[model samples]
Target: MPKVRVHNMTISLDGFSAGENQRIDAPFGDGVGWGDELHAWFVEASRDAAAGKTGTDVDYYVRGDENIGATIMGRNMFGPQRGPWQDESWKGWWGENPPYHHDVFVLTHHPRPKLEMDGGTTFHFTDDTPERVLERAFEAADGKDVRIGGGAAVVQQYLRAGLIDELHLVIAPLLIGRGERLLDNVAEGVEGYRVAEMVSSSSVTHVMLVRR
Candidate 1:
């Protein structure tokens, strides 16, 4: 079965996934200079991986993209834009060719025409519920797993609905002190999930949780 998974979601010691005041210039938002620092592990690991380095961070970073045939993300993850579409020119922060080369479903309240970008990526924006989006994602996945590319609230919705089968998080050593918290709520089904694995590197700790 194709599972719904969240991968390489990095949070701070204060449980912030992203900082406040997110903008095009400041990608991860702003919080005591640690906004960009939160993802340093993954970034460094990615560079290292490119240079033929394999470690806990690099392994987790690589694992995030493995078997991911489709993705569902919130508008925040797509960009810092808010409240309807005044500008349709924002293609995303990933430049012409996005990293996700599969069907990408973006959850949004406003309706917009499906964006077909380079590198085989097509963005479908919708106001549908998590379950509804997941259904379409599964269909687009073509037997591969679906990944929730989140910005906290989106992840919480799926978790509250018990839609995600597995979640892999990278807890960085930095502290944001404020911003988005990945596991803020969704307490109803907390007992249904368990920490299946944990590995620690010098820069961060990789934690994997799976629904029972």
Candidate 2:
């Protein structure tokens, strides 16, 4: 069966997944000291892999994209746009070819037409519920797994609803005092899950949570 998974969600020691006031210039926002390094390990791992290096962190980083047929992300992850779509010109943060070479459903209140990009990547904007969007993602997955490509809030939605089958978090070594935090207000909903694996590299620590 296909599973819903969240991967490579790097958070700070202060539990912030993203900084405050997200903008086009500052993707993760400001006030996050050393918080930009959250995703540096993934980049480092990719570089290491290109140089024929293999380790636990490298393997974990590479594994996040395996068997992922469709992706679901919040509007924030899509861009800095908010409320209604005043300007429909902004495609996304990624240029011509995005990393997700599959159907990407972006959750938002305002609906828009589907965006077809190069490299077999397409963005479908919808205002549907998380469960409904997830179902659509599964249908598009075509027997493959569905990945929750998030910016904290979207991941929290599915997690609170107990929909995610696996959750992988990359714990950075820094601390952001404010901003969006992973697992925020999810104490009750997180009861059904447990940390199944924890592996630490020199820069960051990787933790995997699976349903009990």
C-alpha positional error of residue 73 in candidate 1 after TM-score superposition, expressed in Å: 0.3
After superposing candidate 1 on the true structure, give the runs of residues whose Cα lies further than 4 Å from its correct spot.
32-35
Error of 1 at 50 (Å): 2.3
Best by TM-score: 2
Model 1 poorest 10 in a row by lDDT: 27-36
Candidates in order, TM-scores: namely 0.95, 0.96
Model 1 TM-score relative to the real fold:
0.95
Model 2: CA > 4 A from native: 32-35
